[model samples]
Target: MNPFLKPFACHWTMLDNVRVKKAGDIRLKATRSAVIYCTPCGRKLISQAQIDNYLHETKSKLTIELFVFDCKANMKQHYCPDGKILDADISNGQENVPISVVNEVDKEPNK
Candidate 1:
């Protein structure tokens, strides 16, 4: 199997409209193609074009899903040139997934 298309079981994190420093680049701002994965599963950068193709094939633009494995990886920021915030479903099903950042108080327990 191609290294690019490996079976990666993990949660998806969307770097939507995120502006920040890029990787391995001196430039302060960059869309650095990010590799997304479940912090628990495996890590890999899926291809965005591949995901688009899959959605196109299904002929349903209603639910856009990011495949954790295969060619659904993106090059960061959804490559939106029009500066539009494209709302998407980060779920693997017809349901919505809730995500939250850990609070400082929660970290205290680890200390």
Candidate 2:
């Protein structure tokens, strides 16, 4: 069995206050609230469609990796796009910050 599928207490990033609008629209339309990340692996599973696709592709029966907190272990079980798992440290380090702030920072160009 893949160890990544095992359940663990996960530090989750809750998605809230998400909105979308046309280029000049004054009102921001609210989007559904969701839990976006497991934090430790930096992987996001935002919607049912996405979750279904992942399960279909991986043929995985477990959904625990989508929500569990111990993503470090999960991270070790997967490969990167380059066909390898990242060897460097993996940490979001913003576990205490609001998701809105994190989203803004993610939008900025890396210095």
Candidate 3:
């Protein structure tokens, strides 16, 4: 009988709601994920916002850097800190472009 409380209740109970949201799928497009890789170590750190949040909360601001030895081999797969493999734009993550033009290069020839 309560109208205002209905939406919140729906959000709380339904596992289906979390399954897939827009675009007929739940996984986000690749552009949404961050490009994270560790250098001189095998740990790849994706999710820029999460990383920034960690740095912010911890108050330990040390500049973290990554060197792309081989973009393909390094970025073959990505995972969140929690160990969930991210599916954001994996298609374009592996590419070799001029140092200045990495993101702008055309990686989509399959279309």
Candidate 4:
């Protein structure tokens, strides 16, 4: 196993959009969705339901850390950009495995 990769567990955080009112009060508003990523690799998970299904099928324990951020876009721009999206394939029936698909942003240039 690679030291940098923790494939068995994931991390999830709630992203909130904040706004400043006229009274100079800061308010935190929850977004429509949250962002889930691999603990070590920072690979983004499609949804909470998908990860739950994958963990259930694989009998793997998940370690979640609740981090609240003001902006979802900032978090995606900084951390999730380095890793590709992780998709769990449960349809195969043999074994449940998480697959990392390479997006255009995650591709490397030819040497």
Candidate 5:
């Protein structure tokens, strides 16, 4: 599995946008966009014109990311020109997950 995609988990919400899940004192905010590479291809820079073209052609929201596997091998595939949007949810387990920076006040006192 891709290291970037490993932290993500499927989270369905009634809201029109993505959501973040948290456990205990930890909180994860759903960023509007996050840079990520395609599973089939590597990170490639895209132009504004290309992104606009894709959005117009697909008739999809600008918040969505594009995957271009149909392009030729020589062609570069850039998913997010504006920035990669996070569509998946972050896991909320208390196991061996790496801890992100958090305020000390947010943590509970030791038992």
Candidate 6:
């Protein structure tokens, strides 16, 4: 398993330890065998990652344009069936802003 890829198993998490294949497909092998529940349906669904690896290889560089244009929809679709949309904090081959701030107020002077 790649050190950079963290294996996560939760009601709101996706499968882990994904590796790239020579045929340009992403393979997801679950580390655990427990049944996971779906957030929307409340039904049990096996934690699996069934998306094709868009990139050619791990060593290949990922460009910003490719991320936004090519891979975004494929990834979203992969999770759509399982109803796992990548959260802001979840960094899964996409650009995510960890923190979101609507507005900031100025501090008052000390009394």
The lDDT per prediction is: 0.36, 0.41, 0.34, 0.41, 0.30, 0.30
Q: What's the CA RMSD for each of the models?
A: 17.2, 18.2, 21.0, 15.3, 20.7, 17.2
Better of 2 and 5 by lDDT: 2
lDDT of 2 at 7: 27
Best by TM-score: 2
Model 3 lDDT tens row, 11-111: 31111112223333445343323234332223233444544554456564332222222223433244433233333355565646322222333444323
Q: Which stretches of candidate 3 lie over 4 Å from their true place?
A: 1-45, 64-111
TM-score for predicted model 2 compared with the true structure? 0.27
lDDT of 1: 0.36
Clashes of each: 3, 1, 2, 0, 1, 1
Which candidate order results from sorting by TM-score in descending order? 2, 4, 3, 1, 5, 6
lDDT, model 1, position 81: 34
Listed in order, each prediction's TM-score against the native is 0.20, 0.27, 0.21, 0.24, 0.19, 0.15
Off by more than 4 A, model 2: 1-32, 39-41, 63-111
TM-score-best of 1 and 3: 3
lDDT for 13 (candidate 1): 43
Tens digit of lDDT per residue, candidate 6, span 1-111? 222112222222333344434343556655432322232224323323311122233232432222211212223333222222224344444555453222223333222
Clashing pairs in 5: 34-84
Candidate 4 lDDT over 4-111, as tens digits, reads 123332443332354444343546656434333332334334445655665566576542222222234453333334654344443445646644444446455323
Weakest 10 consecutive residues of candidate 6 by summed lDDT:
2-11
Ranking by lDDT: 4, 2, 1, 3, 5, 6
Candidate 5 matches the true fold with a TM-score of 0.19
Q: For residues 37-92, could you state the per-residue lDDT of candidate 1 as single tens digits?
A: 32222322235554555447657432234244322444332332333222333343
